[model samples]
Target: MSISERISALVGPASFVVAGGLSVAVAIFAAITIERRTIEDVETVLAADGIDWVLVSANGLQVFLDGTAPNEVARFRAQTGASAIIDPDRVINRLDVAAADTAAPPRFSLDLLRNGDGIQLIGLIPGPGGDEAFAIAEAIADIAGEAEVVNMIESAELAAPETWDAALAYGLRALETLPRSKVTVFADRVEVEAVGETREQRAEFIAQLQQDQPEGVEVVLDISAPRPVITPFTLRFVRDAEGGRFETCTADTAPARDRIVAAGLAAGATGVIPCTIGLGVPSPSWGEAVETALEALARLGQGTVTFSDADVTLIAAQGTAQVDFDTVVGELDADLPDVFSLQAILPEPETLASTGPARFTATFDAEDGARLRGRLPPGSIGQSVQTYASALFGADATDIATREVADLPQGWSVRVMAGLTALSELNDGQLVVEPDLLRLTGNTGDTELVSRLTRLLTEELGPGENYDLDVRYVEALDPVASQPTPEQCESRIRAIQEETKITFDPGSTEINDTAGEVLDAIAEVLPDCLHVRMEIGGHTDAQGGEGMNLNLSQRRADAVLNGLLARGVLVTNLTAQGYGESQPIASNDDEDGREQNRRIEFRLLASAEVAAAAGDIDDQPRTRGGILAQGEIADWPFEIRPLPRPINPDGE
Candidate 1:
């Protein structure tokens, strides 16, 4: 073979080999590029969909996803999201879903706070029953009409424990009864905190809760009733021929009570005289003031001492030597605390009247009520006398048919008021007020009445003033026999009204003459119920303008009060309020309902409110015998004060 021919053959073969090698290199480069692009695309898709937990890798056209996903849902989501950027067949899911966590169930509890502002519920409740968790809130809203319900509760998708329902129910019941309270409920326990208006109410609340406590659940109840506030704290002490006693005594603290009681005992007060320890002392020197007053009374030998907050009143017995009264009163006035003002009275002997020494008399019995047949100075004083007597006894229980005498003594009103006040201490009593003397004969359930009466008379009349007491202590004549509970008094009044309505003239406040008998019956009941404070509510149909109806109701209520006053009922503790159509028990849509709506009702005042009102009434200063001076007792210097000096023990 020639060289050219060999070269030609070699070239053809070599070319074929080179060309094949080039083709192989290109294919290898293209495969590497395709793998890189595929991996980049898969990663971009997974990253865009927040599937970072999934690790992405691709071999040629096949994509693999691997990583621990938080949950099956998350894993599935990542797979679906990644597949959207590529063919589903090309995507391989090697991602492992995290093992299902063994989580503990959530603890559940509920707290309920109820007050004047309404009810609030907070805490977690077992669920899917979200609506059921609000059942308590809904129930309170329904019962308390327009009461706000604040719900900050969350419900878990879990079943409530078996004990949860019972505990919750019990807590809800407690909440319903306790207006001012907090109730916490758990599966195994219920805690209730409440405040009551009085100790009795607190006891009732505890008893009710304990009685109705749920079985198999622990219950914790905390109910509190605070001490009542005393206004114009009163202390009355007397030492006479019968020895000494307290009619009413109040102290600010236990130590103060002890001090006051000891001083009273030292001054001749006998028996276990109870001194009320309560709030509201005019000054920290209350004990000192009382002690000084008692000392003065002791020095005077026979007298009464009264403390109305910072004011002190001392009355010397009429027979006390002028020098003795002057010395004691002057010393007491000077020695008393600065906060106290003293009024020392030395009564003058009364002149005899042609008509039995210008007498005033009051008689009381449980069955027949009270009768006031007395001579009062002609004027509004007569009306005042009736009103005063009624306040102490009860309007319905008293009858006043007194003739006004023109010439009653100067201190006659004081004597009358003092006698009536003392008589009220007895269950059944008769008091006679003469110009120069006061005589009381009564049966009392209170063993301490005679002593108290003796003290009151001495204080109001004068130390050593002529007064006689034939009062007897009889269990049957206890005040409880005459004085009914507030509820019972209201019930008795209701029964009387139910039997015969207290009718008035059509569209007028004038009570019909026929209602006189009803008024009289109510008056009889009032005397026995004098201690109870009450409201006489007047209501009218919604036929007239709102303002007119209100005015009409007020007038009617006032008329009723005036009628009771005329019947000799005490109106001090009784108040008249006109509601108009504001608080109607029956509908005004029909005649019968309207008639029912236009009726009078008797309601009991809360004990606290009654105390407040009573205090206001009793706060008025009673300058009976005479007001020796006002302001600081020490200001009245002995040199200037007009008190008689004694000539000698034998010579006046």
Candidate 2:
């Protein structure tokens, strides 16, 4: 082809090539657009069904699901369902439904006021369904794109009571008020505005209102009137000091008030305040008088005078005169010669009764009178002598003495006889006359008579040189004999056994049946007593280990205790003790000796009454032989043979 023809032809072929390229480009664009549209449609459908997904890729009319659906089955159904509208071969299921679900944004519902990007929710969720609100909000944000949530869901709380009774019973207590008939409650802003009389009633209303308020709600009380004051009580007594007619004081204050006034001071108090003086009756002067008389009697080396009821009355008599001429005359006879005379002119009975005074005149022979006058001092004459005589004759006077005369011995003898007669008269016809017997015999120069009289008098009188001469009396002692009653014998046996450390068998633990026979004998003798406490002790020898022996002893003791219990002995009254090698009555060196040492002892634990019933028998044996001697055993009226050992091992 020529240059021009060639250029045109090349242009034509180039144009055709360019057109084919344009067509191919347009077709590819249309396919891409269709796939994209299909994916958008599938997503829309999923969104309406509360499902979410992602468009992974699009190949011609085919589509792939990349995001999660509500469930695995739902995801498969979504993919397959989308393929039905598109092409399955182009759809790649590389999406992990579980992973996608974990990564997916939560769905929510929003009944909100959205201004641009802000959201404000308002609605009741019923029954504290706050979790539902959060879920709905999140879901709405996920579906409609992210947004801010101004959550206004309230916490669940109980409804408030509208009535007073229901409110009062709602766990709220009034300060110091009880619910009453007229109480009422009105709640405003979770507060009580009370309108009522009676402070207690108002308080109840306020409390009931407060009771109905929810937590975090402020309560305000608007009471119309002031609450009544609860005043404390004052204990008032009816007293003159309080301008009352009746006089009164605290009962306990009487003692202190009286004490203050009794100290010789006017207590500062008004009204009739009763007084109690603690002054007691004076001690008897009779005790001092008796003590003085006892001292005087002691000085006289005579028998003591004990004042009985009868003696006290007689001595205390106001106008009574006691003619103690025996004491007076005995004193005179002791000081004077063998012969003396006493002219006792006691005051007349009527005069003594009126004046309560005593007068006595003792006369002596001329020589005796001279001796008496010589013994008197120069100023002791007439009135002085008479005063001395009056003192000797006074009611309180016990004795008197006069000098004896050596000259005119015959008159002295006569005076001595008169003194004896006077002594007999004062003695109330009960004079001992022992000293007189000695004096008379001494003057006669009869050694035998003096000795005999002295011995006789000393034997009859006690360790005294004088006698009371009040009256002669003889007393015969009546011995008390107590026979053993059954109760008494039982008590004695129990006491003896307890004190003596007596006991019974070990392992076999029972009191020997023979012991029962002994007890039966005792019971036969004495029958009234009933209750008894017996202590059975088990002792072991030193042949075994101390711990083992101790346990063995205890078991043995328990065995005996059980035996006693089986025998109808009260469990409370029976006590068992284990003394492992502690108490040994015999040597523990040899087998036989050890056997003897391993023994049980029964002891009677007697009470005081039972011990008292044991009588006067000496519980201690005279000697060790007495305890071990066969004669002593034979002397027991009842024979006690040893009980037979049980045959079977378990019978114990």
Candidate 3:
């Protein structure tokens, strides 16, 4: 039981035991040495300043610090920081310091409130640095979740003035100065209310106020006041210069208006109103008044003078003085003798002084009575009077010539006729007048006879001086010849050789006629009928280009139609068409065949329906005797029956 015995028992097999113990001690030491070597091999990663250690439990590793780092980079370093000491089989990533909060700076709120309500902004914003503001707001909303922004900022200054009383005082002063209007002011805002009866005055007042105001005082204008519309007064006069009573019309009753103003002007007028002054004093005549005025005005070389509402006034400047008839007559004589007549009324000697100017009043009549009646040459007097009288009276003149002749010429008798016989006949059986005959009749009779005739006619008639004559015939003539009947148009269609030396052109239907006899004949016959529809049909020779030949034939037909039209035939009645070589009447291979094929022919269009019906009949043949027909029957050969079987030969 001693140490050695234990070591041996534990070492009695001591020699073997001692060797086993040494081996076991050596194995333990080697294990500790390997662990220490691994510890020394590990890197002491001292991170850059401001960095911290991160213990990661996930992989059992300690990570050192650095300035700033992303979360993912820090985490990876924590997992592998003590890589040399860690067992290869174990993971250590659980402990990592969260990355420093490197997010952007916090945003400011731009939420705006207006009138106790949130305002949503739309459209392009207007403000200084507005784009930057919008960008910031948008970024905040994106980062901190969507939040509405309401803009409450106002850029404009208030238009209201400081004190209401001050504004009212300003308005009162404005109104005082603009007496034509009422002025209203709210704050610095001004409005004009017009009291005048015109929009022009209201506009003028507002414009004046704007011009007088100084800067820095903000003004808003409300021009909503009712505007006064002023209409001008008018006056009209009718029938004032037609030898009728003077009439006046007034549009408005206001004495301050132009209608009344014009009337006032007339009352004090010094110039001529050119009013009518009647002749035959004591009992004036309208015709005489018109004539006298016109003559007097004409002699003065003045234009027509007329009285209007402005020329006559109810207001009296001189207390309604009576017109001085003598002075009016003298004035007419001096200024317008051609347009006026002056007649003096012979007053009884006892009443002469009392009559005043009434004894000689100016008269006026129509121009004919003044200048054309007795003033014309005596032979022309009757016609002149009649023409003017008819124009004035709108009636025909009667045969006062016989009644007015002082003495009839020997063997010269006057006769009167009426109705349509006075008119001559035209070729169309229409009646017309011979101008020379009418002129001769219109200038009828001797000079003295005409003068007497006119006076008598005018006395019989009323005041008018116009008339139509019933023609009286002194001689008779034979009746006119009758018109010829319209014969049916006829023209010779000559053999082609007769009219032209040249032959038809090759491949064409055009014929050349040196004499042009056929064309002349056609021209002579064409005018007889009311209308003639001529059909010119052309055929072409079968030499070349069927289409070209057909077209050429058509051109030839059209040439004929053009020729007829040029000769004055109506184009509506003519038609030209070509049939080409398809309608050849003779063989097309020979010259003679081609000549026949190239013929041009004419046909009267008897009726449009006949041509239409011919087109409706299809070229195909109808079945007969149950046989199927082919080819055009028009080209079928005629068959001659053989001589009757010779029964007579055996009998002979």
Candidate 4:
């Protein structure tokens, strides 16, 4: 029946005015009857449709719903049922739809791209203290120079992330490191696409971005710097008694450079950079030529290869086989790119009687007299060297044993003088010079000295001489190794780690600033413990899903490992392992217990030098087939240390 007809039967028609004519008893009875009928009809429809959570009411002909509905669909269903039984205009739905269950926040991100002309901010960023816009503008202004700013950013009013401040700070800070970059900033992830001015700068920037980012920020970096203009396209490297060095570095591309550097590293070259890939590259075949040339140089093992554009000079050391050198040089000459020409200058082997490359050797202690030995070319060149040495070592504190030699290589005097100058920078180290060879051995406290001198020597000695720096870093001497026993190493690590636990921000893998200090201390001691096998283990409490916790734990473990590597820990000695809720040490039912379980551990896996120093934990050696098994510890920095004899307490 229509609501009007039902009301008419119960009380009266809509046209009937009850203000003065209707009795109170009659109206009350009508309201009660209509309400009962409405409730019954609503319940019947709700049951048929499988919808619930709505209460029906009636005031005379008007019907009302007053209860919480599971959702909008349920509220609509109840209203539809009442409208069928009564006038549609008189049916009212007061049912409240239940609020939605909270879910994880979306990854908030935006990319701010700046170029030569102007700046364009793109992506979504949450308002942080309402200062994000200003921060972005200021950071861009600092780097944009005179370029105009274009704001294309859109923001939303959402809950701020716990690490938004840190993430924003880091992203803004990148503006200084990266002159031109497309920085994508998310609440948890920060990605950068940038260009560096030089290879060194590029590498340093990448290292800084990846290492020890604040807690709750995942860093993704792609930084590249083009190869600079190499005029004459010069190149030189030597391997001899003095050690090996590159007079200058050249690489047409990063991959080419990396391959070249890898070859050098394999051949024991340290602190060397390959050629950049920009201006003055003779041809696209530059990398190929470098690869073949480096192979040949590695084979020679003791010579200098200088390639200035097409002219390639191959100078062999004393015992280099003439036939082998000629064969390799011939192949290179024939196969080199059409734009390049090979000039193989193979000198006859040196005899003892022949005055070889001017020799310069200085042996001096800080407090005692010094001995300057070896030969220099004749005339003013020789005199200038003597004068420089005298001034450097002191006239009365020095004894000169060098003489003018015949037919020394051109600029031999300059190299000798430069060698002497470089030697003076060392506190107490030996510097030796030979034809195409310069070997430096000494101890210094300055870690920066190695890199500085590396570049300095390359510039002074012409980018084609062989140089070896055996300069030991003495930590006592502000600079920098002995292989300490594994026990001593592991104990030292644990001592620094015991008081502080490596914990991550809530649901984040980033290590906070405070935890980085502990990591720094760990890095300092890892050099001594290179012989020890260590595992960086991550664990979690059973709260979230098993898969999620496992993934989180794994990511956190990797983050810690990356952190240690950033702090200068040897990568070979460390392994990152994540054991999620599977290896919890405490109950997951309580917050404190869960916190205990959500921790990172630095555990000693195994070590060769076990008995040298007894640590708090008595770890027994696990041998396989009566020998040290090829396990995880033997991966890198491998060593077989003799177990030092244990001394009796009474000195027996």
TM-score of each: 0.41, 0.19, 0.23, 0.45
Q: Residue 371 lDDT in model 1?
A: 94
Comparison by TM-score, 2 against 4, better one: 4
Per-candidate clashes, comma-separated: 14, 21, 48, 14
Ordered by TM-score, highest first, the candidates read 4, 1, 3, 2
Query: RMSD of each candidate?
Result: 25.3, 40.4, 38.7, 22.0
Q: State the lDDT of candidate 3 residue by residue for 160-182, as single tens digits.
A: 22343233323333433343333
Model 4 per-residue lDDT at 417: 76
- Global lDDT of each candidate: 0.74, 0.37, 0.34, 0.67
Put down candidate 4 lDDT per residue, 63-129, tens digits, no spaces: 7888888778777878887777677998877888899777766667777776667778777667645
Q: Quote the lDDT for 187 in model 2.
A: 24
As for model 1, its CA RMSD to the true structure in angstroms is 25.3
Give the TM-score comparing model 3 with the true structure, all chains together.
Answer: 0.23
Higher-scoring candidate on TM-score, 3 or 4:
4
- The most accurate candidate by lDDT is 1
lDDT winner between candidates 1 and 2: 1
